[model samples]
Target: MQRAVIPLKGELTVGDDYTAGDFFDSVSFRGVQLASDDNMLPDSLKGFAPVVRGIAKSNAQITIKQNGYTIYQTYVSPGAFEISDIYSTSSSGDLLVEIKEADGSVNSYSVPFSSVPLLQRQGRIKYAVTLAKYRTNSNEQQESKFAQATLQWGGPWGTTWYGGGQYAEYYRAAMFGLGFNLGDFGAISFDVTQAKSTLADQSEHKGQSYRFLYAKTLNQLGTNFQLMGYRYSTSGFYTLSDTMYKHMDGYEFNDGDDEDTPMWSRYYNLFYTKRGKLQVNISQQLSEYGSFYLSGSQQTYWHTDQQDRLLQFGYNTQIKDLSLGISWNYSKSRGQPDADQVFALNFSLPLNLLLSRSNDSYTSKKNYAWMTSNTSIDNEGHTTQNLGLTETLLDDGNLSYSVQQGYNSEGKTANGSASMDYKGVFADARVGYNYSDNGSQQQLNYALSGSLVAHSQGITLGQSLGETNVLIAAPGAENTRVANSTGLKTDWRGYTVVPYATSYRENRIALDAASLKRNVDLENAVVNVVPTKGALVLAEFNAHAGARVLMKTSKQGISLRFGAIATLDGVQTNSGIIDDDGSLYMAGLPAKGTITVRWGEAPDQICHISYELTEQQINSAITRMDAICR
Candidate 1:
């Protein structure tokens, strides 16, 4: 993500050194941070996002509003379209969508939206405020400045009160809601929004929308209602996005219109107004038999006999080393005469389960391989079947490959595909190829992904970065593998990056002691850090590099007493205590060095000894030597 920093009450200035790239998906002003209440958290932690589905009769402009605030708006071509990237404004409000066609007609619909329980601890409050220009993905639409704000407070009696508002030049809206934590009964919220919009055509519209959301989990019965909700709206409602461009220029068709116009273009004038919508999502556990889930949504419109619907059901189970799953999907668009349906079945088994235990090597390889099969039948009764074998290679399982062969009964064609993936220390890569016998068609594709970190110490390459990361600094410890990471290690400079560190949480980073060289020793092997969002924290390890030695020494023809202290003249960490046999064991030592031995403060009790190690001995795990203190 990229953001422009704009001062709210001071002059804004920028430096001459500016850079730009296409690495980010979106851009906004820094002051707009309040627009996303959960900006500090990664997308994965934000929980489920609602998906809005619609059927556009013609080239149209789509607008999505939640709790009276416009969240997303864009242009789409005629056909069935699903908007799954909407950044939700709240956890429990329903979404209102308006489709404005090229011929000046409009269709409105509602999408139920909710998340996990919206209960908050007592006496807690959360709020946000945003002031910025209205932004959209459509280039032809005019922009407007707007302000939005929201507040949520935990009240007495296990209740919560939440409200928010949006204001623009020609549009204004407000919403209020109350949520209840019913203890063992579950959690529920009810909200209502009022909106007023003045169109470019000097027309004013006002309407009200009501929404209800509920979430519950029954641990004993193994049932979870992730989200269930319903919403209803009046016919005169108009969102900020709708009012701004309602009367803007639109395409018109005539007898002299271009002959190349698509078939859907002629129906651009049809309009359907939304009335009510219902959404449900539930999952159940079947103990040892497996689990199943059902999710679906339905929408009804005013002044129209047609309704839009989507439903899905799935079940999964496992027996010993075998896994099985069955699923079905159904969908019907508003203006379509026929609905689409599909059913699928899939299963997988470990290849090693059928192998004999006699051949250890072969059996070990088979343990990483699995046989899988899938069959599906679509609405048109076309059946397709595929069988595949997938296996993980390499001792670390960083490399994996899959091969599949399939048949489609509709075309009586045989198809095959192969894919390979490699997760290396520096990057991740994938390559795939597919071919069909029907038309001798073939296609190939490949991708490479990784991240780079630049610090004062130097630059290092690593696996794909996450929202937070840690830079490992262990000087002189080259090629030392990191613990608990796939194919990750320090570079020649003893510097590497640990990507995907969790923000606002303690993360433990450790080096693989077993992978270290004998000449290198780590003063500390593990480090813990709690990083903030988008931070690259530093983890430092003190590493000493040299030879390890175990030398037997004597002072003036007499063995040095036990408990005597020995230290190398030039090495800071090369120190040891003499053992009973007068053997001193020390690491991080040079090939040739002078040692000092002291058993007491008396003048004759201390002595100096000189030692030199052969090349072979210097390279050994533990060099052994004999020295005499002069």
Candidate 2:
């Protein structure tokens, strides 16, 4: 579900009034069951998956697989591509990615994947509901309203039962599954989804898809199967997204237009249906020596002969202060002429290890620097080598810079780049410059980012905010630093905003008492807040603005009896009991005030004392004075 409000006549600027325009408020709801292999949920809720990254020398087809199962297949233009949306069959398994270049060359690499078992405690339940309209980037696509709901219940005897359904005007789907906890063996789950759809041509299609997933960890063998799964769908199976496309006008024949036109091609690509997929991700630990991992997948289409495949693995280890790694990638896609493969080696060493013998503090500080090198050779024997140095600058390590030089044997061209990043109290910034000798080409990049929060109290500038934030309010406590924050402090209004607060959980917001002004006192320095998603919660602290006073009161020539009560006549007065020395130490004192002293209930036991503070004493943080009670 989503909602937005647009001002029709007035500008909708931040920190501005929008009273003149009629607002256009819209609320939209839609629910959909994505293809079994696709998951758009956030990483936290979907569990963890390894990101597959690769460089494509030309246009290519990228396929991601795990546990011998192809989980994802897509096309990419020339350049670096990062695949972060791979849906694994299991919770743990290495991912193998294959990139088939337009020239038929293929490259493959392994991404280590591991995650905790997805076993819920007995009797626990998890559920989600979504209501929204069909959404697509293409304005020409048909749209429909839909609803979806899913449920998971942890049953008795280490079993989990899960089911879900999706409903729409023309499409409907239902799914059910069961998962088991195998104790020492591992975990496994199997599910099936049945879907029915009515196309614009009035044709009805019905099908079912079956999936199996497994995960395990062999502690003694040091082998972990993060994910291993397989899925197969019938020819008639069409996801809701696909069903919507089928309902579009002229989607089947492009309105009698040429079959070779771009419009026809778009329709064909959008209608391509999945047939079967296999994925596997695995990793083995070499005890203290290091670790290695392997991941791969294979996928096939329903109508076309094209198939996508990927395989990748790598080994990494550390020796003293030096870290080393070696990896190989292999990829192949049907219709591509040749397979692509790449071999890479990389290492890094801390400069401090070599400079520890020096006694100079500056040199020791610079020891945080690291020297790194990487070399990769393609199947055609083209090699690229890069050397770089990176180091943190400030003592807090909030500022860092790196410089790198590279040489490509294929072009015999040399290139170098330098970049710096700074994480400040209120913002983060980055700058970079890159130049290549090939064409004397130079590029400059820079960025500055921060977050602003507006609340009833006021607007506050802060570091990059997350989904949730907390606004700290401690009036009169200006310039007081926040705990656990880098150089973050309250402004003159004694207010500051802290970002990245976790939703549905308690977040501790604390102030540094030591940083408070001498004349200011805080009744509470810490507060706990729980904010909802995208919510701005206020955390208020009770702060008193006044002087601290230690006053000795006497009746006639003798000091007041101990245990006597003293109360000042002001809103911010600090009331206290007389100490053994006939003096009372109190905070939040006014410049001049009347104090009422009482000990016993008898009428004669009470006395009133009038006291005045000197200019010097009033200006001081702590004032010492004498007072007479009549």
Candidate 3:
């Protein structure tokens, strides 16, 4: 149920080249991007994000330290809290917070967590700007005007910085980077970029590129390397999307013929290369039989011909019920020197732990199954096997089904898939289907995404919403029902869309008095929001429909002053006291009205009560009235 996605990607490769991409998540500092993930400091180097409010008097247990370690811990639910997803530390300490409770008590607090030198942390600033138009179908309708800008800046001591630039028409580029934090030996970064191009006037391309990065966490060798980057460029770098498609206008050059001026394309010559590159990402943990990873990349080119490499290594573990993994890969190209290796292994098992039962049955609702096996070997000798099976229908598994089979080299294959998810009452849904076979061929596929939220009582559409959301505007009541969201109701123009809130915290939104509409009058059934991250808030539920009376009055006949004061047209509506048989229960009145009752302090102790109602007593239910005060 982790929502938020705006991914739309299309790719067709195998030397055919066709690509389309779109990604999203926003709060506009150019931060937030998901569909797998992003934003690890981008937006010119992010920094300046605040919000860490708190409170909790009972069911506590919150943690959150900083310096003495322990980044965050949870379990709240008592009241007032907001922690905006932490993580920004580059020194400037101060977080703390403890709070244990549930009776055993424990408490502590602190929360300042500084940042400012490049400014960031006072509401962490991250920004991004982009403009687009880059159509291609062999460039016939030729279009190209894409722009970009990014920034991030967490400063002061452990530093952090970022920069950005880009443009099309004749090309341009800029870049900057710096990261610090050294203490026990780890964390370093450096970046540089510069580019220029002229295209049509032929010959102008300039270049400069450099990058280096490293990260660490040894903890006495139970290591955690994270990343180690490298890059270099010289041979006249040219990137600004390769100088607007290598001098556009039907790119065709041939002077000193490198096989008739082929300036690159085999999908951009395997990802933009004019000179050097290297990349590495690392990971390791292995204490309880799990964790190990290494990623790779390499490239070198000038007149091209060879020097490209790829590598991978992986391992994950679990026993006691089986789950394991292994991986290996190697690729080489520079005219391929026979390097294209692969090795793999994976296993997963969970058929309810092989029938030992005990999923806690409350009269059936638990059904589980899972099995997976994958094997591979390659470098030409070929070998592949893949098998999978999954079934989980509800019990919070949100309905699922799967089947797959495979046996290598374009032969024997089978697949089947099914998915269903629902969150009831009004929206939030997911559906999927897939089927495939080879050996005479057959294929089927389907996918649909969701998310639509509008405010002042209108559009709703559900499911996707995670970076934060709201939009429950209850205008004319409509279908009502909203209570903590899930299949949220209200539509037919009353709005609904509680999609997944929780960004700066708080979040609570109730209102299900049997889904309203009985002459409606719910002046606040509950609401609390905090939002921010990828905000979209707007929870206004002050419902109001007409005539709901319950009146008893008297003045010349005495009985008026348990606390008198009432005014309908002049607006005070109902005031203090007045209810010891001087009945009062006035909701959104107005079926024809006049109510004016006052008490003591002379002035003839005011009284003016006249009422007329029809239209079936203002639409049914609570409508019993009688008012008379001289």
Candidate 4:
């Protein structure tokens, strides 16, 4: 058995402590809050998803097809294999798996996979449990032990139920929710949360919160309502964190009991009365013309007389390789004096004009030069305008650079930035840099981001694994090419990592036939994986290395018999009768070995032949030699 612990990407904590109001750095396991893709998780937390598995007779090529369409292809060694996390259609269909052996033999089988509306044939149950001591940004002796566990279950009749509870010191909260499909209309969900808190000097307080969510896609109207939500909470309602902070002794909303602290102003904004909130997101498609979307959110607080509101809409389309987009934004603060509004437009055009026409000139390319402009005027009559240009490198969008010039109420300024994304055998990585010029003042900013994975084999550092990943193990098969990934090859340990895998979708991985060693044989040339969300899977391949040779042999100056049997050191081996040209082929030989040939069972009919090889030729494949039997 093997075990490993991996941290999720972008799940770190870097914020000011509410207790002492100081900067703090830490890590969060929020990434694991969802279902994991691998089986390493405990049984109670395992995602109940469909998977395909089988055994190959040798290193063989594997292919899976659904409804006559090839969905996955990969290579595997001679062994039992399993494939999980395949994104498949929710319909009745049989999956076909074909295994092609190195010796030209073919074998195939079928796996049944079908989905029904009333039953959860591929549904899953997932869970997560976290226990840790909360760390604050400051060293003001603020520590709390917290624990949370959640369970998600998908059942028949298009039903999904989820529930969880959390506790921290004198604070506790419980939440439950239910969701179901409405067939062609869409889906809806409802949730309820209850909390109770106790303080050493104050009476116990309890509160409840209610929320509703709705989403739908109108295929006939070409419209999609992505999200619609409404939430309400009582005046006494407090989250677990809020309760814990309120009871902690010596904690203040503003530092040192002062209301004029410069930094405390922003922190104070986070603490507010609980009342109600509404949010909506909707979009529409116009076929070849364009698409548009509208999004908005509003919140009202009980203690504060003012309310907060934000609304935005945008449209985007492409014409003859030129893409265009326009958007408008509006926002109002709870107690702000005036509301703000802005409008922006952007366009992207291919830069092929920079390339001169030649015999090898190509027409449809993706490298682009983009331009964007924005104008804004608020209720106070203040106006602003800004312009920017960007360039993107093609071939998988690995590099992008941008430059901007803007004239705002403050003044004119110019800015430039660049970013790069790369995927390597060990990890994936990204880096970005930006520079700004405001009159005589200039500033430089940069950032670096990546992920790290520690698994059964060891710890590996790379780019974000996204939702799923795979580690390939092919001992002694170093330098093997991994297809579909650019510039990815097996390392010295015959290990290569695929950092990004589509959750619940079929992903193909194959070996480059040209990179194999002549003396070695691979059982399979291709393999496929379907991974669950956030799961790390393993792919194994088998290889064999040995001496291989052919020879021309004669008995007493005459051609050997047609039915002669050959043995290596008295052990029977792969042998074939001499052809019309007096040549025979054999395999599985050892360097400097002896072979005995016998046309009959009698001892006298047996004859021995000896051969020797220099060190250099011993490791060579398909060597031809001549020997005489007397």
Best by lDDT: 1
Runs with alpha carbons beyond 4 Å of true place in candidate 1 = 1-31, 35-113, 200-202, 244-271, 353-367, 550-585, 594-611, 624-630
How many clashes does each candidate structure show, in the order listed? 0, 38, 27, 23
Each prediction's whole-model lDDT (CA):
0.69, 0.68, 0.57, 0.56
- Among all windows of 10 consecutive residues in model 2, the one with the lowest summed lDDT is 16-25
- Please report the TM-score between candidate 3 and the true structure: 0.29
lDDT of model 2 at residue 202? Answer: 67
Which 10 successive residues of model 4 have the least lDDT summed? 17-26
Please report the candidate that would top TM-score against the real structure: 1
TM-score of each: 0.77, 0.72, 0.29, 0.59
- Residue 265 in model 4: lDDT: 11
- Across 426-542, the per-residue lDDT of candidate 4 in tens digits comes to 554556444434434443444455556667777655454554788777665677777666546777767777777765467687777568666555566677887655668777766
- Per-residue alpha-carbon lDDT of model 1 for 365-470, expressed as tens digits? 3137889787777779877777888887765678889887777787787776788998888899999877765538777979999998889998899889976799
lDDT of 2: 0.68
In angstroms, the error of model 3 at 27 is 26
How much does candidate 2 score in TM-score?
A: 0.72
User: Which residue pairs in candidate 1 have backbone atoms (N, alpha carbon, C) closer than 3 angstroms, thus clashing?
Assistant: none
Candidate 3 C-alpha lDDT tens digits along 193-264 = 887776543667678877666667797767766555666777666654444453333433323324433322
